[model samples]
Target: MPTDISRLVHNVNEQGFTALEKTGLRGQQDQGLVSTLISRDLSGSDDLCVSWGRILPGQHHLCHHHPDASEFYVVISGAPLVHLGDTDYRAKPGDGIYIPRGTTHGITNDGDEDVNLVVGVSKPADWQFVADE
Candidate 1:
């Protein structure tokens, strides 16, 4: 995925950020989960991908795993109950959540406000989700 280097740099002010495709939870729609694409191969960076994501208040996403990318989520606001492997924890602002490649994980926003997160992946690859059933 090669991008034009003539205008490779990005800024939050100059152009609006791209929104991550609203792929529903496990092919189901209207799930109140939002992911906004911030960086990827189109950004001229093939090493990593980044996004801004949020779960609507009182919403929860089903468990899923990424096969090729180690995922990281930096809590930006609100408390999100994060489930990783066999354990779960309440995440707060400034907290960094790590999900190893192939680890089963999911998150929920049970609080009064939306759980906002800055999500990053080690590689710029299409996310491969394996439903934890």
Candidate 2:
């Protein structure tokens, strides 16, 4: 997708008001496999971005980092293995995980079903996708 912030301002009044079924899946198909249920670009936000991420069973989100933005995630369903820096945190429903800017982190769904998460990030312009190692 384009990195231009100008194209990310489709708000509620501009046809952005809808649910997950109305939106399409996002993320790299080969590696960062996941679906974005919602996003700031779809909600008319430039500074911050939020979305619901869904990872299928036995799939991994691939370790990566946002060089200029802080990221966070709230587990909505199933167990998501969150890898942060030098440790791994198993996050269940209601668990909130925070990853500082420039920190290495990722998520994995090793359960038998899908893992859903509410993900948020600051400085949407600085979002970057990187490898775990």
Show where candidate 2 strays beyond 4 Å: 1-40
Cα-lDDT of candidate 2:
0.67
Against the true structure, what is each candidate's TM-score?
Answer: 0.76, 0.70
- On the 0 to 100 scale, the lDDT of residue 51 in model 2 is 64
State the C-alpha lDDT per candidate.
0.73, 0.67
The residue-by-residue lDDT of candidate 2 on 1-133, one tens digit each, is 7587545543333342222221113444322233343355454566777766777786676677778789999988998788999899888899988899889887778888778777888864446666554
Measured by lDDT, the strongest candidate is: 1
